[model samples]
Target: MKQVDLGGSGLNASAVALGVMRINGLDSDAAAQQVLETAAGNGINFFDNADVYGDGECEKRFGHALKQSNLQRDHIFVQTKVGIRDHAYDFSKQYLLDAVDHSLQRLGLDYVDSLLLHRPDALIEPEQVADAFNTLQNAGKVRQFGVSNMNPNQVELLQHSVQQKLIVNQLQFGIKHTGPIDAGIHVNMSDPRSVDHDGGIIEYSRLHNMTIQAWSPFQYGFFEGVFIDNPKFKQLNDELQKLADKYHVTKNGIAVAWILRHPANMQVILGSMNQGRIAQMAAGANVQLTHQEWYDVYLAAGNNLP
Candidate 1:
């Protein structure tokens, strides 16, 4: 897979990241190691997980699997999101600190390559979050900081207190659910349909040099079935199939290629447990979609090209 700079942080990670959300259901050490080893074999250096994923079970399984595989810690970039617990959002200094400790203990690691605030907490106190993040950074517990599903203003609010650069902003993105990119393409037109809901989050990331990690790169909607073979997504799938044939790749691979083709330095977080699916998506990183082909897929997503 191709390597991309994780923002301007001087850290390079794979453009395709293997997300461990489904690892919780795997049997034991060997089962989990199969999933992880498949990722490593594909040259995917980035592995993303969340403390809330399987209520911490995912991290535990991943930790055990890594140890069993005997993979070197320095050879991979592992990230996990915090701030969601007990069905509530918590970014308070105490929760952040406690959560990091628990996460480290669970993952059996001394540090995480990056830590992200999973979701925006309406009740967040930016200073408290900053304090906890600073403590972690100073203690060598976390190497970098980021946020997920945050708008630009929320990022600005947190930036006021955060001394470290927020290097990444992971958000949902795919050919079927293309709001982040679509909003930019159709920004500020006279028609209400052309108005955006994202408030230019994509543009802001590009301007500030933050990497945009795309989660759910194949889902038609939020956790809905993938659009790759959905009959309702016939138009989109037709174009995707053509691209797949043109490039001699799988349809799922073409779906991922659409996101990698972007100029924002994006990372596609693949949420698959099947090892073959992992390899297929990783191959998309090698595909460089042309401007015409990229735009063609965009139009197929039901976005008008004004």
Candidate 2:
């Protein structure tokens, strides 16, 4: 697929990323290898992972699969997140340092292309985080840094001290979950869609040139389930099918295309472990939906323009 500048970091990455959160569920290392190879063959060079995914089992599996696939380290960009502990968020300097080392060991790599704070820690000390980042960068353990599930203010709080530019903010975004888009469109309105839940993070990211990585692009209601063929989203599925037929792609491809149609230039993280499904979703990068078609799909997802 298509490559874009990740924020303004000068790092060119695929518009679609293979999220390895669920790779641990695969039946064998060869299966995981196939999934990763299929994605790379389709031009997906970005891989998203987290220290806590499958309790770190996913990262271990991915490392093994990568070794088996014979893919060079420089060919792909690997990113993982930290800061999430067993029950609380920890961004302490020591924790951040240890977390990157653990992730590196698990991934069988010298350093990650990027490291992110999985979630904001309410008791975060920006100075300590900055120190940790400095140590990591100075030691060549992490090339870039970012945050996830954070509002604009929280990003600002950390940016004030961290020397590296926070280049990404991963968020849960899909056709059915359009809080960021809703707040922008419904500006100055008295409707519920006008409520600013993310502290104008969408606008902030755009303004600051931070890439918003859209995670779980097919799921609705926070992992309640995928809405692609669910009866509850009949209207959405019907519209997706109509576009899929027009584009000669599967409904999943249409779902991915709808996310890429946005002007934000955000990366859609695909969490599928199926090799065939991975290829199908990656094809979405080639389908450019018309503006009307994009809006049609959006509205079909139970959202109103207001």
Candidate 3:
């Protein structure tokens, strides 16, 4: 797998990351271990997790599985998110500090390579967030920080006070869901795609050197379903299959390739817990699609250049 600088943090990370959100669904410890081993063997060194994933069950399972695997702590980068609570978002200093402690205990690690705010808290106080980050960094609990599902303004609001550089912004991006790309292409046009729903977040990340981690790269309509074989995306599936045959990989691989083909250098976080699917998707890191092929797949997904 190809490695890229994770934003401006100076940490090298794999272009593809294994998201452990679904690890809680594994039937056994050995099964989770196999999945982790497969991912590490296939060149995926970055693992994404969240405090609320499976209600923290996934992190516990991944910790146990990592203990059973041969992969060393220094060989990989582990990241998790916080700020999301049962009823509302909480970014208070006490909550942030407590969240990292619990996550470290569950992951069996001294500190996470990175910690992110899962979602924006409308009542967030940037000073409190900065204090929490300072405490975490000084106490050696979190090495870096970032956010998820946040617009550029939200990031800016937090960055104004946080001492640590916010290095990442995780967002939902895929061929079937192309809001970021849409706003860019349809710029200056009187079209629906010209609406900047994200407050120009994609451009902001690129400008500020903040890495955008693309989560749920295969799903459409906010977890409505994967579009690979879904009849609603027949054209997109057909194009993906054609590219898969050309590259001698699975359609899933082609899907991943399309995401990596972008110049943003964003990491594609795969949430699949199945070992076979993990291997198949990782193969996309090796397949470089041509510009025309990439655009073809984009148009096939019901998007217009405008």
lDDT of 2 by residue, 102-177 (tens): 9999999999998999999999999999999999999999999999999999999999999999999999998878
Off by over 4 Å in 1: 190-193
Worst 10 residues of 3 by lDDT: 1-10
- The C-alpha lDDT values of all candidates are 0.90, 0.93, 0.92
Which of the numbered candidates is closest to the native, going by highest lDDT? 2
Model 1 TM-score on a 0 to 1 scale: 0.97
The deviation in Å at residue 118 for candidate 3 is 0.5
TM-score of each: 0.97, 0.98, 0.98
Residue ranges of candidate 3 with Cα displaced over 4 Å: none
**Angstrom error at residue 266, model 3:** 0.4
Let me know the TM-score candidate 2 reaches against the reference structure: 0.98
Q: Which pairs clash inside model 1?
A: none
After superposing candidate 2 on the true structure, give the runs of residues whose Cα lies further than 4 Å from its correct spot: none
Model 3 residue 95 CA deviation in Å = 0.6
Residue pairs clashing, model 3? none
